[model samples]
Target: MATDRRDRTPTADPPATDDEHAAHLERSRRVWDRWSDWYGTSESDFEPIREAAIDRLDLQRGDRVLEIGCGPGVNFERVRRDIGAEGELVAVDYSPGMLENARARIEAHGWENVRVLRADATTVEFDDPFDVALATLSLSVMPDIRRAAETVYRSLVPGGRIAVVDIRSFPSGPARVLNPLVRRFLRWYANWNPDGGVVDALATVFDECEVVDTHMAGTSYTVVCEKRDAG
Candidate 1:
């Protein structure tokens, strides 16, 4: 675990109006709907990173888990395997097409303990807290990464954990040479900067944020973190 010592306060964009935010969400949903079926086709290489991030979540039997942006339920099998039948899974995403695909996957597997909800992860509220949370390839595409991260922080119980796997556009040392190409490609491919201070935002929201792994010339990474316990 490589500790992040950068400034905890990542720069924030000005708040968007309600209509602007809604339009943003709608646009993102449409893009995801278009990409949902094909997302895994091009992303097969990331399987190991995703697996490692899931492992860092430190899942346990009967633990309740929250998966933000649970795109097409790609993670359900492994996560369910970790938590078992006694556990509960609540996965949320804003795209109906993606959720439909997820539902189909759920039905195919006949997973009884999993629930899928279509909602904006940034604003969705829950009455029950989660033991562990996951956000893989999701936060960087969000309109407000900090707000979404804070929401995840609030959704967790004291001492809960979260694992995130996504692009790391900014890297120091010799890897920094790829920064320009990385950011450009992300914007062109995803219409957003996916790794924009995401680890920093998580650091601000959680007690600890560690870069557990980096891949692809240091262009992407996995982050694992733990929320501080409230005694």
Candidate 2:
């Protein structure tokens, strides 16, 4: 088994005072801006999860897709492929550095049907509704999970699908009972992203939802949601 440092290291950041948390978000933006230079090197870890999202979406030709917080544009091509050669894709992320990576990927691939934007995920607005929307691991760091989920809901067309994959304090079934403990231990680790829990926060916004155990040593999960008629 390949033991990845990002996976094995804790996910919860140290306890942050409101000021510390604000400063951290600012630092996070700068760090990822620098990471744009090394974006491609991070693709290996992204492939599987990207594939999972594509497979689960099961899109058709000409489908319109929206990706929130699309770091380094890792999944743009895959989503385009899923929608077929004629489909359209719109990807947004808050970091200019990350958007730079995303733009490079799109340009490198010569994908003419894609649009990239440097904007916060919570406030992204699409020109038109999409057939499907994805937040692939991006919402895990969101400061406002419910608001973000609502924005996703409003961005989609009727009966459109939305999927979010994120990391949790624990991995699976009965073992998940230890999340509180795991969360406590991880709080002391560096790089711990302690944004309030997304899974629970999003439950109030979607009508149909399902969660599945994913990769990274079963430490992460994917949540698939369907927009309601009224939502």
Candidate 3:
């Protein structure tokens, strides 16, 4: 069996200082911009998992949805289908190149209900609340997972749902042996940390959380959460 290149790795660097964090964000944006084209074509293997995450959102017709780190708008069609013509989909990403690709997709498909915005997921705010929010294979790449999760939590209306899918470190087992090669591949291609504490971050903000393990020997996990009533 072939192994995915997103398994266990070394620990991520400690939390960044304000200035250092800003620089890291900028670098990440630039890297995605450079990789936008290839990323869109090379990630076919992740499509099933991505679609599974979207399905867990349980979106309804006319629902307002927000997608963070929506690279190249890969999930646009599926989301549009779920939400229908009356619904709205907002796809946000920090990389201009990636957003450009997403825009092209929207134009080609004539999906007027879909909008793409260029912004950092951690800092962006929405004036209107969303019914559902999704972050697929993205939370691990965020500069500050907790802050990003908080932003998403606040952007959703009470009772809204949020779903996140991301890579995680493999537990001790035969799979552990593949860690070094997988880590090297991820570091070289995307600068992503498999063990980025994404689940813990979401748990801090959501009223309830359900975790599901997927892919090779649980190399990745998805978390689905529901917003609690504001007291």
Error of 1 at 176 (Å): 5.3
lDDT of 3 by residue, 139-176 (tens): 88888887788888889999898888888667568878
The residue pairs that clash in candidate 1, if any, are 140-194
TM-score on alpha carbons, each prediction: 0.89, 0.78, 0.88
Sort by lDDT, best first: what order? Answer: 1, 3, 2
Question: What does the lDDT read for residue 208 in candidate 3?
Answer: 72
Give the poorly placed runs of model 1, Cα more than 4 Å off: 1-11, 170-181
The better candidate by lDDT, 1 or 3, is: 1
TM-score of 2: 0.78
Superposed model 3: Cα runs more than 4 Å off: 1-15
Model 2: CA > 4 A from native: 1-25, 171-195
Report the C-alpha lDDT of model 2 over 107-196, residue by residue, as the tens digit.
Answer: 898899998887656666777888998887677665556667778888888788877777667556777888777776544322335556
Worst 10 residues of 2 by lDDT: 1-10
Candidate achieving the largest lDDT: 1
Error of 1 at 48 (Å): 0.7
Tens digits of per-residue lDDT for model 1 on 68-143? Answer: 9898988999999999999999999988888999999899999999999998877999999999999988888777
RMSD of 2: 7.9
